[model samples]
Target: MAKSKNFLLLISLLAFFPLCFSSKTIGGYLYPQFYDHSCPKAQEIVKSIVAKAVAKEARMAASLLRLHFHDCFVKGCDASVLLDGSGSIITEKISNPNRNSARGFEVLDEIKDALEKECPHTVSCADILTLAARHSTVLTGGPSWEVPLGRRDSRGASLSGSNNDIPAPNNTFETILTKFKRQGLNIVDLVALSGSHTIGNARCTSFRQRLYNQTGNGRPDYTIDQSFAAQLRRRCPRSGGDQNLFFLDFVSPTKFDNSYFKNLLAYKGLLNSDQVLLTKNQQAMELVKQYAENQELFFVQFAKSMIKMGNISPLTGSRGEIRKNCRKINS
Candidate 1:
C-alpha cells in the first residue's frame, strides 16, 4: 500500500511539474494563456487593431514586425524601444538603427489605447509588441505562432544596446551571427529570422556600399547580379537618395515567403547582410538554399526562432511595471 501511494505521488508530481514550468521552458514566467483570465479579449483586441492597420497600409505589417525584433534585441523585449526620451530615459528610438527608420509606433499606440480601455493596466507594452509581431506575420501571409505573453515594460531604455545589439544591414556574416548568439540565438535562428526581410523595405543608404565602392575598391559588389545592381543603382544613386525605399525582396515585396532566400541564391539579396547568408558561410548558405527550395521548412523554423527570440531575458513576474501608457513608465 505504501509503495503504491508513493508511485501515485511521484506520477502526480511529474504531471504537475510541466504545468508549473512549461512557461519556463520557452521564457521565464511567460505563457500563452497568461491573459486568459486577466483579459480574455487581449489577443482578440490586438489582432483586430493590427488587421485594420495592415489593411490600411500593407507595409505596416513589416513595420510592426520590425518593431518587435528591434525591441527584443535591445533590453530583451521590455518595450524600451517604445519609450520616448524624457529626463533619464535615453530612448532607443533615437539610436542609429532606429532614427528615421523604425516606425509603427502609432499602430502600437492604437492597440494599447484599446487594451487600456478594456482591461486598464492589464497588458504590458512588451506583450503588445510580441502579439503585434505575430499578427503582422500572419497578416502578411507568413507562419503563425502562439506568442508567449506576461512580459512587462521597463522603466528605462538602453540607447547603446539598441545601437550596438540590433544587427546592422552592412554587418558581416560573422558579426551578425555573433550578435544573435549573444542573445542565446544560434546560426539557424539567425538565418530563419533574416527571412523576415522577405516582406519589408530597405533604404538605399543600407546597401549603397554594396552598389558602389564595395570594399572601398570603387566597384559594385560582384556577388550582386550585375544587371540587378545596375537597376538598383539607377534609383539608389551614388550620392543622394539615402532614404529611397526598395523592396527587400523585389520578387514578392509585400508577401511573406521564401523569396528572400531565393533572392540570395541568385545574389539579388538587397542588403549585404541578406546576401552574406549565401556568400559568407557554408552552414548559412546551406540553410538559405534549403529554405529557398522548401518554404514550409523555412516557415516552421522561422516560427520556432521567433519564439526563441521573444524569450530573450524578458522582464517578467513583478520585476517590471504594467505601464498605463506604452510611451511612458508609471510615475
Candidate 2:
C-alpha cells in the first residue's frame, strides 16, 4: 500500500506541475524545448544563410529570428514577415534594413536543412527563429541565454498579417510605442530595439512623413542624421518611391550593438521614431547610454525582450492554424 501511494503521489505531481509540463506542450504540439545548448550546428546554418544573401550582406539569419520574435510577440510569430501577397513568400523582394528578417524562406531553408540533416525535422521553424535570435544576439555581443525549444511553426502567413502587425520604420513614436507596450516591453526595450533601426534604411514611403510631414508628426524630432535627410531629399526628390532602404548605421549593417544608441546621441538616428528616444522617452535615452557603456547589459536585456516577444499568444493548441503558405495562409 505504501509503494502504491508513493507512485500515485509522483504521478499527481507530474500531472499538476504546470511549469514543468506546460512549456513542454506549448499550444498542444510540443516545442520550445532545450534540445541544443549554444547550438553550434544552428549557428553554422545561420552563418551559411547570411553568407549567401546580398540583401543580408554583413547580416545574420539570426536577425530573421529576431524579426520572427518581433512579429510573433506583437500578435504571434506567424512568420508574417516572410509572407507575400498570397501569403507564401515574397521571394523576389526580401529583408530590407527595416525588414531585417525579410530573407524569410532563404534563412528558413538554411536552418531547416541543417536541422533536418543533423537532427531531422525534430525542431520547428518557429523554434528555429527563437533559437537563432538567441544565438545571433550572442554573436553580436548580446546575451547568450538558453531558449526553450520545441516551438512548432505556424503553417500560415499573408500580406495582411505582415502589414497589420509589423511596425513600420516611420510610424509615430506613439504608434510603435503602443505596439511594443502591447508585447509587455518597456520604453527602454522599445528604444533599444528601435535602435536596431539606426542600422537599417526606410522606404520613401516609410519616411515620407519625416521629410514632408515634419513638425508635430509625433516622431522623435529630427530623428535621422541631417546629412542622411538631405541625401534622401535629393534622391527621393519629394516624388517618393526612389528613397530605398539604406543602412542607418553604415558601419556594420548586420551586427547588433550600441552603435545605434551612439548614433542617436549624435543626432545620427535614422527614423523619426528612432530620434524620438531622446524627447519621447528620456528613460529610454538613459538606457541607450548604459547599453553604449556596457555590452553585457544590452545582451541580457535584449534576450529577455526577445523571450518576452516570442512566447506571446501563439496560435498553439488550436487558437490559430499552421499556415501552409505564409502569405495566404488565412485566405
Most accurate candidate by lDDT: 1
Model 2: which ten-residue window has the lowest total lDDT? 91-100
Residue 313 lDDT in candidate 2: 53
Q: Candidate 2's C-alpha lDDT?
A: 0.55
How would you encode candidate 2's per-residue C-alpha lDDT over 173-196 as one tens digit per residue? 688777777766667668656654
TM-score of each: 0.92, 0.70
Query: Which candidate has the top score in TM-score?
Result: 1
Worst 10 residues of 1 by lDDT: 11-20
lDDT of 1 by residue, 1-331 (tens): 5564354335434433443365453335777889999999999999999999999999999999999999999879789999999997889999999999999999999999999999999999999999999999988988776677789889999999998999999888899999999998999999999999999898999999988866566665778998899999999998999999999999999999999999999999999999999999999999999999998778777877888888788888778899998999899
